[model samples]
Target: MPTITLSVKDENFAGKVLQEVLIGFHSETVTIRDIIEARVLQEVEAYNQKQPQYFNGLVQPADAEKTVNGYQLRNKVVIDPEKQVYVALDAFQKNGFFVLVDTLQCSSLNDKVRLHADTRISFIKLTPLVGG
Candidate 1:
Protein backbone atom coordinates (compact mmCIF):
# COMPACT_ATOMS: atom_id res chain seq x y z
CA MET A 1 0.00 0.00 0.00
CA PRO A 2 1.36 3.35 -1.02
CA THR A 3 0.08 6.83 -0.31
CA ILE A 4 -0.25 9.07 -3.33
CA THR A 5 0.17 12.75 -2.71
CA LEU A 6 -1.75 15.10 -4.96
CA SER A 7 -1.63 18.84 -5.12
CA VAL A 8 -5.13 20.24 -4.86
CA LYS A 9 -5.41 23.87 -5.85
CA ASP A 10 -8.14 26.47 -6.08
CA GLU A 11 -7.58 28.77 -9.02
CA ASN A 12 -9.38 31.32 -11.07
CA PHE A 13 -9.87 31.67 -14.83
CA ALA A 14 -6.59 33.56 -15.09
CA GLY A 15 -4.60 30.63 -13.66
CA LYS A 16 -3.87 32.10 -10.27
CA VAL A 17 -4.04 29.86 -7.26
CA LEU A 18 -6.18 31.16 -4.41
CA GLN A 19 -5.47 28.27 -2.09
CA GLU A 20 -3.42 25.13 -2.36
CA VAL A 21 -3.16 22.01 -0.24
CA LEU A 22 -1.38 18.72 -0.62
CA ILE A 23 -3.66 15.74 0.11
CA GLY A 24 -2.72 12.13 0.42
CA PHE A 25 -4.76 9.10 -0.51
CA HIS A 26 -4.02 5.44 -0.40
CA SER A 27 -6.28 4.50 -3.25
CA GLU A 28 -4.82 4.93 -6.71
CA THR A 29 -8.22 5.39 -8.30
CA VAL A 30 -11.12 7.37 -6.85
CA THR A 31 -14.28 9.09 -7.91
CA ILE A 32 -14.56 12.84 -8.20
CA ARG A 33 -16.90 12.68 -5.19
CA ASP A 34 -14.12 11.22 -3.08
CA ILE A 35 -11.78 14.02 -3.96
CA ILE A 36 -14.33 16.67 -3.11
CA GLU A 37 -15.21 15.06 0.20
CA ALA A 38 -11.58 14.75 1.18
CA ARG A 39 -10.79 18.36 0.42
CA VAL A 40 -13.82 19.70 2.23
CA LEU A 41 -13.25 17.46 5.23
CA GLN A 42 -9.64 18.54 5.56
CA GLU A 43 -10.56 22.20 5.47
CA VAL A 44 -13.38 21.80 7.94
CA GLU A 45 -11.16 19.92 10.34
CA ALA A 46 -8.63 22.72 10.34
CA TYR A 47 -11.33 25.33 10.86
CA ASN A 48 -12.91 23.37 13.67
CA GLN A 49 -9.68 23.37 15.60
CA LYS A 50 -9.27 27.12 15.35
CA GLN A 51 -12.95 28.16 15.14
CA PRO A 52 -11.97 31.05 12.94
CA GLN A 53 -14.26 33.81 11.82
CA TYR A 54 -13.20 33.32 8.20
CA PHE A 55 -13.49 30.02 6.45
CA ASN A 56 -11.46 29.31 3.35
CA GLY A 57 -13.09 26.20 2.01
CA LEU A 58 -14.09 24.60 -1.27
CA VAL A 59 -17.71 25.61 -0.76
CA GLN A 60 -19.28 28.33 1.31
CA PRO A 61 -21.08 27.18 4.42
CA ALA A 62 -24.72 27.92 4.98
CA ASP A 63 -25.40 31.30 6.59
CA ALA A 64 -21.92 32.53 5.75
CA GLU A 65 -21.41 35.87 4.11
CA LYS A 66 -19.22 35.62 1.03
CA THR A 67 -16.19 37.85 1.24
CA VAL A 68 -13.52 38.85 -1.25
CA ASN A 69 -11.17 36.07 -0.22
CA GLY A 70 -13.43 33.64 1.61
CA TYR A 71 -16.60 33.32 3.62
CA GLN A 72 -17.11 35.16 6.88
CA LEU A 73 -19.30 33.60 9.52
CA ARG A 74 -21.36 35.70 11.82
CA ASN A 75 -19.63 34.08 14.73
CA LYS A 76 -16.87 31.56 15.24
CA VAL A 77 -18.34 28.06 15.32
CA VAL A 78 -17.33 24.58 14.29
CA ILE A 79 -18.35 23.93 10.72
CA ASP A 80 -20.09 20.75 9.70
CA PRO A 81 -17.95 18.89 7.21
CA GLU A 82 -20.84 16.72 6.01
CA LYS A 83 -22.95 19.72 5.16
CA GLN A 84 -20.09 21.33 3.28
CA VAL A 85 -19.45 18.13 1.34
CA TYR A 86 -23.08 17.88 0.35
CA VAL A 87 -23.17 21.47 -0.78
CA ALA A 88 -19.99 21.04 -2.79
CA LEU A 89 -21.31 17.98 -4.61
CA ASP A 90 -24.51 19.79 -5.42
CA ALA A 91 -22.56 22.81 -6.64
CA PHE A 92 -20.49 20.65 -8.94
CA GLN A 93 -23.60 19.16 -10.48
CA LYS A 94 -25.14 22.59 -10.95
CA ASN A 95 -22.00 24.01 -12.62
CA GLY A 96 -21.24 26.34 -9.75
CA PHE A 97 -17.63 25.31 -10.21
CA PHE A 98 -15.51 22.90 -12.19
CA VAL A 99 -12.82 20.38 -11.43
CA LEU A 100 -9.72 19.83 -13.51
CA VAL A 101 -7.75 16.67 -13.02
CA ASP A 102 -4.44 17.49 -14.59
CA THR A 103 -5.95 19.27 -17.61
CA LEU A 104 -8.90 16.91 -17.98
CA GLN A 105 -12.20 18.41 -16.91
CA CYS A 106 -14.39 16.29 -14.69
CA SER A 107 -17.98 16.00 -15.89
CA SER A 108 -19.67 13.98 -13.20
CA LEU A 109 -19.30 13.28 -9.52
CA ASN A 110 -18.91 9.59 -10.35
CA ASP A 111 -16.20 10.28 -12.89
CA LYS A 112 -13.20 8.07 -12.27
CA VAL A 113 -10.04 9.99 -11.51
CA ARG A 114 -6.70 8.29 -11.70
CA LEU A 115 -4.31 9.40 -9.03
CA HIS A 116 -0.59 10.04 -9.31
CA ALA A 117 1.95 11.62 -7.03
CA ASP A 118 2.39 14.55 -9.39
CA THR A 119 -1.26 14.99 -10.22
CA ARG A 120 -2.42 18.58 -10.12
CA ILE A 121 -6.13 19.05 -9.46
CA SER A 122 -7.49 22.52 -9.96
CA PHE A 123 -10.93 23.80 -8.90
CA ILE A 124 -12.23 26.90 -10.63
CA LYS A 125 -15.37 28.49 -9.25
CA LEU A 126 -17.67 30.38 -11.60
CA THR A 127 -19.07 33.66 -10.42
CA PRO A 128 -21.82 35.38 -12.37
CA LEU A 129 -20.94 38.87 -13.43
CA VAL A 130 -23.00 41.64 -11.92
CA GLY A 131 -25.86 42.78 -14.17
CA GLY A 132 -24.37 40.98 -17.16
Candidate 2:
Protein backbone atom coordinates (compact mmCIF):
# COMPACT_ATOMS: atom_id res chain seq x y z
CA MET A 1 0.00 0.00 0.00
CA PRO A 2 1.12 3.54 -0.73
CA THR A 3 1.89 5.77 2.27
CA ILE A 4 0.90 9.38 2.83
CA THR A 5 3.08 11.49 5.07
CA LEU A 6 1.99 14.64 6.89
CA SER A 7 4.71 17.20 7.47
CA VAL A 8 4.63 20.25 9.71
CA LYS A 9 6.84 23.26 10.30
CA ASP A 10 8.31 21.58 13.36
CA GLU A 11 9.74 18.07 13.08
CA ASN A 12 9.84 17.43 16.84
CA PHE A 13 6.18 16.50 17.05
CA ALA A 14 6.42 14.45 13.85
CA GLY A 15 9.19 12.39 15.41
CA LYS A 16 7.09 11.78 18.52
CA VAL A 17 4.13 10.43 16.53
CA LEU A 18 6.40 8.08 14.60
CA GLN A 19 7.86 6.79 17.86
CA GLU A 20 4.41 6.19 19.35
CA VAL A 21 3.07 4.40 16.27
CA LEU A 22 6.28 2.41 15.82
CA ILE A 23 5.95 3.11 12.08
CA GLY A 24 6.46 5.95 9.67
CA PHE A 25 4.07 8.76 10.55
CA HIS A 26 2.84 8.70 6.96
CA SER A 27 2.67 4.97 6.52
CA GLU A 28 -0.42 3.17 5.16
CA THR A 29 -0.52 0.94 8.25
CA VAL A 30 -2.11 3.78 10.28
CA THR A 31 -5.91 3.88 10.38
CA ILE A 32 -7.97 6.82 9.13
CA ARG A 33 -9.95 7.21 12.37
CA ASP A 34 -6.71 7.61 14.29
CA ILE A 35 -5.47 10.29 11.89
CA ILE A 36 -8.66 12.38 12.02
CA GLU A 37 -8.79 12.14 15.80
CA ALA A 38 -5.21 13.23 16.18
CA ARG A 39 -5.69 16.17 13.80
CA VAL A 40 -8.90 17.28 15.53
CA LEU A 41 -7.38 17.03 18.97
CA GLN A 42 -4.24 18.85 17.95
CA GLU A 43 -6.24 21.71 16.41
CA VAL A 44 -8.56 22.04 19.40
CA GLU A 45 -5.68 22.12 21.86
CA ALA A 46 -3.80 24.73 19.89
CA TYR A 47 -6.84 26.99 19.74
CA ASN A 48 -7.63 26.61 23.42
CA GLN A 49 -4.05 27.31 24.48
CA LYS A 50 -3.89 30.45 22.37
CA GLN A 51 -7.23 31.69 23.74
CA PRO A 52 -7.64 30.22 27.18
CA GLN A 53 -9.93 33.07 28.22
CA TYR A 54 -12.36 32.37 25.38
CA PHE A 55 -12.42 28.64 25.95
CA ASN A 56 -12.62 28.81 29.75
CA GLY A 57 -16.40 28.40 29.76
CA LEU A 58 -16.99 26.50 26.56
CA VAL A 59 -16.00 22.84 26.45
CA GLN A 60 -16.55 21.35 22.99
CA PRO A 61 -19.29 23.73 22.00
CA ALA A 62 -21.53 22.64 19.11
CA ASP A 63 -19.83 25.29 17.08
CA ALA A 64 -16.68 27.29 17.76
CA GLU A 65 -18.93 30.32 17.01
CA LYS A 66 -15.81 32.07 15.80
CA THR A 67 -14.40 32.32 12.30
CA VAL A 68 -10.78 31.62 11.68
CA ASN A 69 -9.85 32.83 8.17
CA GLY A 70 -13.52 32.73 7.17
CA TYR A 71 -13.84 29.03 8.11
CA GLN A 72 -16.29 29.08 11.00
CA LEU A 73 -15.18 26.46 13.50
CA ARG A 74 -18.61 24.87 13.61
CA ASN A 75 -17.36 21.60 15.14
CA LYS A 76 -15.13 23.17 17.78
CA VAL A 77 -12.07 22.05 15.81
CA VAL A 78 -9.25 23.98 17.39
CA ILE A 79 -5.52 23.44 17.66
CA ASP A 80 -4.06 21.73 20.72
CA PRO A 81 -0.73 23.10 21.80
CA GLU A 82 -0.16 20.37 24.37
CA LYS A 83 -0.42 17.87 21.52
CA GLN A 84 1.64 19.82 19.06
CA VAL A 85 1.33 17.29 16.21
CA TYR A 86 -0.59 14.15 15.21
CA VAL A 87 -0.19 11.32 12.68
CA ALA A 88 -2.96 9.08 11.39
CA LEU A 89 -4.45 7.52 8.27
CA ASP A 90 -7.05 9.23 6.10
CA ALA A 91 -10.33 7.39 6.73
CA PHE A 92 -12.55 9.21 4.27
CA GLN A 93 -12.36 6.23 1.94
CA LYS A 94 -12.07 2.49 2.47
CA ASN A 95 -9.64 1.67 -0.31
CA GLY A 96 -6.12 1.06 1.04
CA PHE A 97 -3.97 1.30 -2.07
CA PHE A 98 -4.58 4.92 -3.11
CA VAL A 99 -3.17 7.97 -1.37
CA LEU A 100 -4.38 11.55 -1.09
CA VAL A 101 -1.74 13.74 -2.68
CA ASP A 102 -1.23 17.13 -1.06
CA THR A 103 -0.41 19.04 -4.18
CA LEU A 104 -1.95 21.56 -6.55
CA GLN A 105 -3.46 18.69 -8.55
CA CYS A 106 -5.60 17.74 -5.55
CA SER A 107 -7.04 21.21 -5.00
CA SER A 108 -10.41 20.01 -3.76
CA LEU A 109 -8.81 18.39 -0.73
CA ASN A 110 -6.51 21.36 -0.34
CA ASP A 111 -7.82 23.71 2.31
CA LYS A 112 -7.06 27.35 3.08
CA VAL A 113 -4.23 26.24 5.36
CA ARG A 114 -2.31 25.21 2.25
CA LEU A 115 -2.05 28.85 1.22
CA HIS A 116 -0.47 29.96 4.45
CA ALA A 117 3.25 29.35 4.69
CA ASP A 118 3.36 30.27 8.37
CA THR A 119 1.24 27.26 9.38
CA ARG A 120 2.31 24.61 6.92
CA ILE A 121 0.32 21.36 7.31
CA SER A 122 -0.97 18.77 4.86
CA PHE A 123 -2.80 15.40 4.85
CA ILE A 124 -3.00 12.73 2.17
CA LYS A 125 -5.90 10.32 1.90
CA LEU A 126 -4.50 6.85 1.25
CA THR A 127 -6.84 4.65 -0.76
CA PRO A 128 -6.83 1.45 -2.82
CA LEU A 129 -6.70 3.26 -6.16
CA VAL A 130 -4.26 5.95 -7.24
CA GLY A 131 -7.10 8.25 -8.35
CA GLY A 132 -10.14 8.54 -6.16
Error of 2 at 3 (Å): 14
For residues 18-60, what per-residue lDDT tens digits would candidate 2 score against the true structure? Answer: 1111112434433434434444454455556664433321112
The 10-residue segment of model 1 with minimum total lDDT is: 123-132
Runs with alpha carbons beyond 4 Å of true place in candidate 1? 128-132
Model 1, range 86-106, lDDT digits (tens) per residue?
888888888988999999999
TM-score of each: 0.90, 0.31
Candidate 2 C-alpha error for residue 60, in Å: 10
In candidate 1, clashing pairs total: 0
On lDDT, the candidate that comes out on top is 1
